[model samples]
Target: MDGITGETDSLGVHLHYDLGNGDRLQLLRLATVAPDQPLAALVPLDGDGLDRLEAIDRLLRTLLGRKIPQDTRLTPQQRRRSRHMLQAIDGRMNGASYRDIATALFGADRVNDHPWKTSPLRDITMDLVKDAFAMIAGGYRTLLRRRHRGS
Candidate 1:
């Protein structure tokens, strides 16, 4: 027999199952559990045998398919920020000036300040643009490879 424990938090659900024979499984940020799904079917109530192993395999597949919730993965504000950064990077690639990108994103008054090079807002914007460009170049590919390796 296996004992199951679960809890929910801001990220999502965390689950741990201990199979009596020393095998254990831990799952984090499981998006959701369908109310009508036969969760109990994955646990053998009678005996621990080949049937339980098969059940575990099926459960793993089903849970992996669900994926982590979007909010748990990235907040709405973060998503918007990333989108803006990508737009700024695209504008730069198209030969738009930093001031022009700033004006388009934050308005003329915010970007028209003298000594723009020393401006905090301008510096932050430039940093974001640089990061976006790096991501487009090779950082994104590295991230994807890391994700696959981790999985």
Candidate 2:
């Protein structure tokens, strides 16, 4: 009998089974199995008229062929943006006005010509401040937790 092996990784899961009489099967989880599918209903003792090994192999092939779920973690750029937003929040807490923070971060030109209430730069800066405060309140913990889980 040939040796059989199975492996799972970020891409998906794979299984290989060898029957002693030169037959072999390879199964890959590329998609989820449907509840009403024949393979989903397979059991060890209920092979119908097919060979037990063959039935098992078919069932495994169908069941295992599913794509691995994609990771939804933040990208490096997003993390950097979060850090910058936190810095803006810190600036606000330290007595800097919205215009001051905007000038400091985005340069004087972006803040000098526009009225405070209507300035796009001010709006963006305020949004960052809000996001930063949200992070401080609890959202930052999610990042820390993800880091620990990933490690």
Which of the numbered candidates is closest to the native, going by highest lDDT? 2
Backbone clashes, candidate 1? 0
**Tens-digit per-residue lDDT, 1-151, candidate 1:** 1367878887556667774569777766435655344343345465343445554555655455544322233457756777878889988989998878888888888777756887776886797799898888777643321112131
Q: How close is candidate 1 to the true structure, as a TM-score?
A: 0.45
* Model 1 deviation from native, Cα RMSD in Å: 15.6
RMSD values for the candidates in order, in angstroms, are 15.6, 16.4
- Candidate 2: pairs in clash: 29-64, 29-65, 29-66, 30-65, 30-66, 30-67, 31-65, 31-66
- For model 2, the run of ten residues with the poorest summed lDDT: 34-43
Q: What TM-score would each prediction reach against the true structure?
A: 0.45, 0.45
Question: What stretches of model 2 exceed 4 Å from their correct place?
Answer: 1-72, 145-151
Which stretch of 10 consecutive residues in model 1 shows the poorest summed lDDT? 142-151
What tens digits encode model 2's per-residue C-alpha lDDT throughout 1-151?
Answer: 1365767765455657664468766655533643243323334554232344444554455446644343335677887788779779989999999888888888998787888789999989999999999988888856632223331
Against the true structure, candidate 1 has what lDDT? 0.65
How many backbone clashes does every candidate have?
A: 0, 8
Global lDDT for candidate 2?
0.67
